[model samples]
Target: MTAIELRNVSRWYGNVVAVNDVTMTIGPGVTGLLGPNGAGKSTILHMIAGFLQPSRGELVVGSRPSWQNPAIYRRLGLVPERDSVYAFLTGEQFVLATAKLHELADPGAAALRAIAMTDMADAAGRRVATYSKGMRQRIKVAAALVHDPEIILLDEPFNGMDPRQRIHMMELLGKLGAEGRVILFSSHVLEEVERLSGTIQVMVAGRLAASGDFRAIRRLMTSRPHVFLIRSSDDRRLAAALIGRPEVAAVELGPAGLQVRTSDFGAFCAQIAVLARDSGIRLRELLPTDESLESVFGYLIAN
Candidate 1:
């Protein structure tokens, strides 16, 4: 199986450190590289794609260093965040050029196949300059996929896509991952990462904050309180009951709803319904406000 590995990888620019001693193994399947802006996600993707070399430690793709290794491109496909397509060339022409560069036997057929995969076949004949931002993103994905590589690296792949385009791209990536092709994409959008990837590598201030299952990581953060927003028939009564529970650390009644902070998430979840039932309060909405990627990232960064 194709895999990317990093061992104490560090990339620095004079006084600035971009990727700071981060190490993780990205195996076959969909993996999300998640972080806020300026969190070194793009830098790591660029280094893995062989656009930049690590300043220290080791970075490898398929057991070989990607830096100064032209052969790595054979098994790797990259859809970069930046707009790198030539506006003058038609979408089909651009993809065909990429296929030719890869020295494919039938570049035209490969380009056509990739264009169809990206749902860009209808607009493939039009010049890239006439396409919308989302269309351009699709064209770029087509060019990247022209060679049918084993490992695909995408940086902010859903940047300009509309809801329909985004859903299609997500489905396409999921399908590719299911076929056992290593797929890694970077995104700051918590919902997108959570919805698409089972595994995520989180970056915070150039360091690897967390890795593996996001939900598992959240569970491991026992020190941080789990917050919830609850709306019921009797908010005041529910709050009064919740404040008396040993599992609940704090409770606040606000205009939105009752915000409950619980040290024991599982315990609180188990008791909330029972407490409501006993208090004769009808439960309306029970949302775990901090059970999201954003909250996890925030906790990691803060710590």
Candidate 2:
């Protein structure tokens, strides 16, 4: 299988380290590179694309070192975060130009195929400058796919897309990954990353913080108590009832509702509705305070 491997790789500039000593393997299927801003995701992608060299250790694509290997470009396609399209050219023209640049045998056929794949065939004749942000993104993806590369790297591909456009792009990526291609994309949006990839590589402060299924990672974080914000018809009564439960570590009554800290997340969830029903308190709202991807990432980084 064609895979990218980083073996104890680190990149630095003088006293500042952009990517610390880390190792990971990226193979077939969609993999999400998740991190906050300046967390070395872009730095890592650049190194994989051979645009930048590692300061120390090894970076390999397939069986060869990615650095200084021009041949790797043939098997790799990169959809960069920055806007690099030619605004004056039509979408068709842009993709055709890219196919020509790749020295494909049939640039027109290749360009059309790519344009159709990205759902941009209807707008193929429109100038890129006249296109919307989502249209431009689709065209860039079309150009990236023109050569039929085995490995595709996208950096924040969903950044400016509207909901419908984002959904379409995601579906297209899902198809590509299903075909057994190596699909890797970097994003700071946790929800998007979680929905799009089965495997995730999380980066924090230039270090590999976690890897593997996010759900499994969350289960391993048993040290931190789960917090819930609950609103009921009777806050004080609900708090009184919950405080006695062993699953609930602590409960604080407030104007909004009760702030609950639970030692057993599963048990607390299982009993919350039944308890409320039996107490004759209507449950207005029950929200997990720290279940968002951002909150989960914060916990990982903190510990």
Q: Among these predicted structures, which one has the highest TM-score?
A: 1
RMSD for each model, in Å, please?
A: 2.5, 3.4
Q: Whole-model Cα lDDT per candidate?
A: 0.94, 0.90
In the range 97-142, model 2's lDDT, one tens digit per residue, is: 9999999999999999999999998999999999998888899999
Q: For model 1, how does the per-residue alpha-carbon lDDT over 137-231 read when each residue is reduced to its tens digit?
A: 99999999999999999999999999999999999999999999999999877788888986999898899999999888998999989999999
Worst 10 residues of 2 by lDDT: 212-221
